[model samples]
Target: MKMIRNVAVGISGGVDSAVTALLLKNKGFNVTGVFMKNWDIRDETGNCTVEKDYEDARWICDKLKIPLIQLDFVKEYWNEVFSDLLEKYQTGYTPNPDILCNKNIKFNKFFDVARNRFQADAIATGHYANTSFGPYLENFKENTNVHLLQAYDSNKDQTFFLNQIPQQTLRRCMFPLGNYLKNHVKTIAKEASLHKIAQKKESMGICFVGKREFQDFISEYIDDKPGEYVDLDSGLSIGKHNGIHKLTIGQRCRIGGCENAYYVFSKDQKTNTIIAVDSGIHPALYTDFLITQDVHWISEEPHELRHSGVLSCDFRFQHRNPLITCNVYKISDNRLFIRLSVPLRAITKGQYAVLYSGEECLGGSIISYPGPSFFALNQQNSIIETRCCDLIALTSGVQM
Candidate 1:
């Protein structure tokens, strides 16, 4: 609807991003595809999977007749994303590296590389997210305020992963697939003679760890730090693990000859111990509050929180989990204290807690540590009735 603008589309060799480039071309924008190589490691089979992905990305660029640029961010990724992930793992924290990748690499370094190096007027990605800048940045104008929102396809919405990036970075971005469903994006790709790309399996979570066992891949980075499996109730050692990094909270770590199956309730890095409960759904696995010192707000801080020192909204620390009601208390400019409507299972420290008011993404903060578990509280006040539950109950499901 206006003068043609040069757009740098981050093509990740997937169906969604391939279609993203096609959409930009169809919209009369000067589309240029850039494929970023963030990781250089091969899989267990000694095959460089990233090479195959790059080939597919090249094919798409050829078919679309748009110039493709390849950028190597392996160094930046190692320093910005991987090192921190390893540190968190070593400390017995279950961190989501995807969100960090988005914040530091995609929206941060990629934005700078695309704009300064390539003369890109704007940036585009295959992410399923939207902005107040309009779906395609069609309504974007200088100095106008921007707000991140969930994609039309809520199932594939990636706003949680994007909540940490800077506000100005979002202002100059375009999400062409924001309003399109996964199937529809595939249909568009197929109709445009890019069916093979469309048929490519979607990349979920981290890509560098492709098809490799997480523990095996991670072992290459972190050494084996032996730890003990202690019973949460009796405080007795029931089992031992070669590495605490290999285990996570809420995971069923049952050992033979034990009186009952046990689930991980917590991890003590200093003591090199993994605390466990007899039942997977033991009340010890649930918590209703958490504190965080790293909180990022989009656009501006909410007026309600600024004035009243509190804000109630929907929250979910995990992307696939359903949004739950919560009240956010502003402890400081950089700190938050969140109280959930219902006690949730395995609310681990180091995971990001994203809060939203309806569809709009307000902000997110890292879960520094969870409050006392129901089991811990029961010892003091006998609040929750404990039970021996099955492994199936150990999920993100709410606990009343």
Candidate 2:
């Protein structure tokens, strides 16, 4: 008799995860439901919905006839994810905590616990992404390995969040909902009589913070420091802001009595100023090049990037705008200089610039700073020096 594979599914008490568990159970595998409690802190109202989620998870596990394993990683999440997130915001850059959560908590911590404790062959999630074991076309010398791919449901594809996940961790993972559309998954849940799970509304906002306002939730951790709002074009003081930490690049600023809505162009942390522009189409809001640090390739660095020094990229998640074609120049072992074919708006610092080749997710890096267009910088005879520990300083009158 053949032995069945024992698979662990990360259940988040949602329809996606519940259906993922059900699918695996019917597929003849020994399935186990694991509920990861990464955040347990309550908001100002003294409410935390984790207990309700736990109950929902328990109900699903009972229906599926599978044992549910509960694991708490609140301390690890606070140290690894939340600390870095706060630091990024403090430095005047908006960071994506969802990507960090996937890399640090879900794929790393939870992955380790499931593999070591449960001795499971593979772990599965409700994420809308697919993985395949195949010989990489770029590196023909290596053996077949796991590679992350976009799901069939383009609208719901989550390869963006999973981009930073290591290839080794991906090898031991399964995405049961990868090939199915969101509606189809709901249809399956309805047919299975999991009506409550099917009708459960999807949670939004930050992963741990639930539906609370972002600024309000963040203010709890960091106190508001008032600052000046200045016009970037005229370099004139316009108004006052409660906190620079509450603002982000490209966000609209509502200066009282100004009919024209001004957008945030940049923030000067040293001077405690928020630079605003009259129009969203301001030249400072767009950039044709950017510098990135800590670049991570999914399998291996593409041969073209190393040799030809160019590749196609998608710098943001679910960006429906035309794809960005850019040239990749290596600044160092851990840094890259990307020159885009066209100017991209709101090229904010601290956001992940994810790269891709067709449908394959090639991973990404944190955008350190937006660089001047090669043409413009060359015309000005500018020289950029990396003097302040990975900080690029332009010498020819170009200021970010």
Give the number of the best model, judged by TM-score: 1
Local lDDT at 283 for model 1: 93
| Weakest ten-residue segment in model 1 by summed lDDT | 383-392
lDDT of 1 by residue, 153-229 (tens): 99999999898978878988999999999889989999999988978877765788888778788899899987789
- For all candidates in order, the CA lDDT equals 0.88, 0.81
Provide the global lDDT of candidate 1 against the true structure: 0.88
TM-score of each: 0.93, 0.88
Q: Residue-wise lDDT of candidate 2 within 1-400, one digit each (tens)?
A: 2232788899999999999999888887889999999888876678788888999999999988999999999999899999999998999988888898999989998889888999876788999988764211122222346778888988888888887998767877888888899999999999998999999999886866667777787898889888888986678888988777888888998689776889898889998899898988876777788899999988888887777776656555233444566777888877988887788888888888887777888888998988563334553553443343235335544554
Off by over 4 Å in 1: 1-4, 382-400
